[model samples]
Target: MIYRREIDGLRAAAVMPVILFHAGFSFFSGGFIGVDVFFVISGFLITSIILEEMRDGTFSLAAFYERRARRLLPALFLVVLCCLPFAWLWVMPEEFRAFSDSLIATSLSGANFLFWFKSGYFAPEAGEVPLLHIWSLAVEEQYYMFFPLLVMVMWKRKPSWMVAVLVAIACASLVYSEWASRVFPSANFYFLPSRAWEFLAGSICSLVQSKGQKRGSDPLSLLGFGMIAFSVFYFDETSPIPSTLAVVPVIGAMLVLLYARQGTWVSALLSTRVFTMIGQISYSAYLWHQPLFAFARIRSIDPPPLIVMGALACLSLMLAYLSWRFVEQPFRRGERRLLPSTRSLVASVSLVLAAFITFGIYGHDTRGIPWRLPAPIKEFMADNDWSKTCLLEGSSGWDAMPIENCIFNGSHAQTYAILGDSLASSLTPALTKRLDGMNIGLQQITHSFCAPVADVSMVPHQARDCGAFNAAAIEYLVKSKVKTVFLAASWKIFFEQSRYIFNGEEVATSDVGQRLRDAFDKTVGALTSAGIRVIIVYPHPRGDTEIAAKVAKLMHKGTPAPTITIAQDEFLQQSSPSYAYLDDPKDRHVLRVDPAKIFCGREAGRCDLARDGKTFISDKVHFTSAGAEAVADEILVALRQDDIMDGNGVAALSSD
Candidate 1:
């Protein structure tokens, strides 16, 4: 197979946007499309090579795999090995364990599956993952594992039959991708089944070229360039990718491969010195960029400034160039003699495999090596107790009948319900204990990210059946004749933002807020009409710092604790709309509980995240056990003062 200078230039085009986007440049929001571009290019080149080998009757699976190992493993292994020391020095125990898991997964070509279970590609914590980009490589490698054999079996057939088969497969993949992007989006993004069509698009191009198709016109080449540029600039995180919209870039890449021949403007420009050079080191550049940016984020107290991130991008390119020159080229040419024989290559791979497997076991068994940090820091880093089993998860729609565990003191005659998102779930530990002691039964009906509002839908990041979940909870509360319903959520998240991503498009926050307000009114009216009391719990104070993690970092550094705070004025200003809607003194059945006053007093001027050497806010919003207890105390006081509970702290039930 001959080298194509223009293909290398195209590689440069694919990589730079990804690096810039990951570096926090807001303008290149659609830079993630670069991965799609890479998939197409890989398919075209690999298929071209395979088809040529088959034509010459020299195709051998062993030779193909050996070449693949030589090309991919050296630089990848180096990158992972370089990450270890820094990971030990900086990463927390939980994250380090996750990193170790990724190391093993990447080695086995299963990183894509691992991440699919863990998180979405564009999630907030994704930036903290150094090896997240390896998912794409895993996808391609997994495809190649079966693709070559299939091609070999079909190579003897007529050209038309082969094309039809390939087209059929690609069409099935595209249809699945479209449906999955709407339903199981993270899996669609990370997994190969939904993404195989992009590669097949390139494979089709290779097949066409092999059948003596005419070169695409110069105008077609220019049009292909425009389409790719349009996608790079216009698409964003909200785009429903791997769907029909993705066909634009896939077709663009196909056009370039088929049409942009020698002397064409697209070919001449791509074959330029600068583009060709970056393309040459593109693989190393992709590998190097993520770790540098991720580590920088991990070490920083706040998000690194644009200038700092920009400098790190430059540093990644420099390192990539060095890696390509020394590590990648030497091994490819066998000049370094690292894998001079097939047996040596196998031995090296086995050693790497054993090392990563051992490390993974150690990390998993030791629980991220907690002994590395001081006891205080370790304790601080531990997850909140409420996350263990109290939170309801997994089901998107409401159960036909409530799970037995969801109802506490099932034998008791009188029941009260607690409802909302995780905020309400966190209050369970304190609320259940108090109610149990008083011989009053409690039923917890909480869904994560599902606000207990009627007929309102949250953003796509939440569960799809959130509106249904909320409706079911409301119906259950009314039908079961619960004495009181407690409502809680991170209300400001919906009302304060300018916009949110919903069903793969941006919707105005104001519209969502109005919907929430309408739902709140209808829900409250229904509950009150059914003769149940409604207690609307206001949101707790949130801070910019992740208090527990910051405290742990401070202890690790042996530095004096710095005060973590959020301005009371800012909190009030942001949450005022929610408070105004929920807190209506004129409504006889509705009682409002303001825990913010207890959490953030005006005398203090700002909310203090830590009290008496203990962190209060476990994460940004949800409370620690102690914090939950404090808020529950405030609720208890409010209930007694409002005559909803007796002097003995038992519920003032009508039956009693």
Candidate 2:
């Protein structure tokens, strides 16, 4: 098989935009489609080789796997090796653990499963793990593992019938993906079964050689190319991804791959040297780009400016070149090399060992390694059972609590109350700690993402059920006769609108803050009027990184002492603006709490809180257990003692 420069150009076309999109350039919103583009190209290339081998009666499974290992593993292993220090130095404990888990997953070609359980590649938390890109490799590798054997089995038996079988499978997977996108979105999005059709489509293209099939007129290719280009430019994240809508890019890629050779200008353009170079190292480039962008974003403690992002692009290209030269080129080129059988045995055993080692490392926190939490600080942070009261997001029995029992129980504890949204629930560890100390039994009634805002101004969503649930929660909160109430939420998320898809449709809506403010005011007013003590725990300072990372830093330094703290002002200066939309002057009943000073503020604006300089907020807003405790230690005093007698420091509510 001849090397197609045009294919390389196609590779360049596919990778550049994905790099740009990840770098925060909003212009290439649809640049994510680059993965789909790569998928199509891979199917064509790999299938072409397999078919060639099949025709010559030389397609041995052993040789096929050896070729795959030699072509893929070296560069990948190098990338993983390079990331170790960066991960240790920059990633917090929780993130480090996640990275370790992903490392194990990637080594074993089970990254697709890991990522499916973890969430989408675009999820904010996902950017922290360096091994995230391996999911794609896993998908492709899974395809290679079985696709060739399936083709081999069918090739002689029913050459024509195989296409129908594959097409049927692809169609079925598409239908399953579309449904799963609604029901089990994470599973559907990350798993190979849902994504297999894209590769299979390309396989179909390879099976039907260009000379044998209908070229369909020159106009068809033009239309296909135009559709693909249009998709790259016009589609945004809100577009239902890789569902039925994915057909546009897949079909367009198929068209371009099919017709590009037949003198079409689009094909000629894609065949250029510049494009070919981009394609040549597309794999390494893809692998390196995400970690670079993610690290830069973490270090800046802010989103990367355009200039910094540009520098990252240059850095990525250099890394890609280095990887391609040293790692990729050497092993892939068949030289005076080991026999295929020998290579296969070595590769298989090594992969299996890598999997076992990785799993062992990630199976426990700190890989089950024990270390001390600093003396005085250890006492402060100790004595809290993390799981007894605080509920894990997907933990069993969390949401099953009866509505009547939704009150905090540490005091004269028969009455019930619930407060806040997801952020509030995170505080359960801290809340449970204090409540347990007081010997009070409290029932926590909570919703995962919905906050109990007082009004009905929504950002307009297609999920009427979610919007209705928000409404129902508010009504329930307002009507419930609990003696005391607590309020919390990621106030930042409420005001900001995220552009995402819902069941194959594009939908964008404002954050929940504005829509929720009125209800907040009314709820507080009503609770206070009813003579029920109501408390609004003002949000803690937002950080740019995961909370676990910060705690991990402290843990790793061999200093378990709580002497060091991050500055409230510095964190606010850097991250509060992103969340400032929730700060409305009209809402006076809301109490304010700034735990940023408690956990991160020993120095002026410089938090030596973490062993490293990495920020500690996971993704953008949620806190890990360590982060939540740091804040809880500061605010819990005020909460438990009733020091905040009223909305402010002034004595508005009497102990009488």
Candidate 3:
């Protein structure tokens, strides 16, 4: 109904943190709360306008939707269109496939659902997605599409009943969100029902304000602003979004919107030129930052230094201003000649959507357009994992593993087993190859992300029954007369998360860490007591970025297929848990295999990631066939040094 420079200033407030947060600036840890702030502001502002229009009998759903399409689509399509060339040139095949999926989903206003499904604890490839940020916009757009019709239908009711309905819906959604935040955190984050309460908070604000609710005083508005600032600084990625914790920022925004009227101190401050200007271009600013940062990350071998990211953040704003000036304005505000009429605008939108959908289908169907890469790069990206079929990952744990089949020779004397997560699976080809004709058999019992340790996990998690599976393996090994077992995994990967569950209580990883160590010790004790020889393969060095993609990008850009490496000392420092067990001279009964002897070369104290022109790491942490062979050689050397080896050079139980 009326322009509020303060509202524009608040938009500036919301957008800046989101930009900085995505840029990986540490100080902006709670910066993700900015989206919550925007949700509240949008609900308030949009509801306020709809109510004003309906009161004047001038609200047309078509006009309302046209304005929304005008306000949003031009800048959005422009951003996605600009990202296409870079995505074609830079994104690796797998990541490009995901990018195409997001492009299609965004065009359909369903990116949130697509992203929700793709999310997982181990989804490292997600960072490469430039369209990842569009999930929020989808949530917002869904609200815009639904809420106006809701208000229009309900407007004919008595005032009190209308307010009551809004209140009931908000309460139900808020209650549901709180519960879902614990059980379905990812879905809660992306789903509309869980996030609807935030919009309702603002909707209630508009209703009360239009009914002559008193303007907020200086103290109240200032407190509102302070709460917003607190969430921005104090919250973090671990914070449960849309839960009761979100009430802090939601109420903060509600207060600022309701109380910070024209002359109020908070309003005066927000009305400043700098904030208003950024706020004016905030939509475009929000759209531009993610692609810039993601592409920069995709290109760099290392995490881009903050200064470079900082420069890119600033560049996003400059581009935002330019597009806001030239592209967004002409399509949204000018003589209407760009589309000329609503029919033409709808046609143009549908055609553009079809084009993106076709492109996405092509990219996805063609496996991220393999033709885009040079033939040699395609060779580098080829399926290098020796055999994926035998890996007992996902729900296929102890029961699903075909123990007797994967073995080199089950009919031979003793059958040994290798057990752990995907890291262990990655090492299997070489290990199985080495053990093929060793007179004894080698079996695979590995499952991806299933911790090798016993008695602990992120409980109630949607993963395979790791504790049950591991316990079964122990029982199976004893029952099957398996005398030797190889234990390996990316040990530190589990503790990288924020929260864990142990002993029926919610606990921090600090508690989980101790339980992990104890669990491993308990597992070893169980095995050794059964007269089974155990070889614990220490974790290999992990690259900081997606090593395979980084290598491919470099080679694709003519970097000569160079050697890639990471600091050995740094890797060991992070891997102290595995080292502590392996390094202990006091415990010599349980044998150990150190992969670092092969992966972490002594040259300059850095772990060499490549043996020749080709990098061996398949991704950030998993090994390619060559890398697996290197680690397997270390395991072979350890076998040679162990008493398990017979004098004839075949590995066996010394007792046998």
Question: Local distance difference test, per candidate?
Answer: 0.80, 0.63, 0.80
Q: Model 2: which ten-residue window has the lowest total lDDT? A: 379-388
Task: Judge candidate 2 against the unseen true structure and give its global Cα lDDT, from 0 to 1.
Answer: 0.63
At residue 53, give the lDDT of candidate 2: 84
Task: For candidate 2, write residues 1-656 as lDDT tens digits.
Answer: 76656678778878888888877788888888888888888888888888888788888887788778777777777777777667656554445567777777787789989887766767766655667778889988998888888888888799768779989988998898888776566677677788888888888888786337635446767776776777788888777667888889889888877777736677677777677777888888998988887766554444669888988987998899888977787666668443335656476649755764564375345732222333432332232112223322222333333444344553554443545566777666566565566564455655555454543322333222333344454455556655556666666555444532222343455443343454455656666666555555555566444444344444445544323344666656654643453344233343345554454545555654443422234434555466666665655555545643545532222111
For every candidate, C-alpha RMSD to the true structure in Å: 5.8, 7.6, 4.4
lDDT of 2 at 80: 76
C-alpha lDDT (0 to 100) for residue 107 of candidate 1: 83
| Model 1 Cα lDDT, one tens digit per residue, 383-490 | 432443346654643576464577887667777788878878878777777777667678888788767777565655454556677777788778776878888877
| lDDT, model 3, position 440 | 69
Local error of candidate 3 at residue 332 (angstroms): 3.1
Using all chains and alpha carbons, the TM-scores for the candidates as numbered come to 0.81, 0.69, 0.86
Judged by lDDT against the true structure, how good is candidate 1? 0.80
**Candidate maximizing TM-score:** 3
TM-score of 2: 0.69
Better of 1 and 3 by lDDT: 3
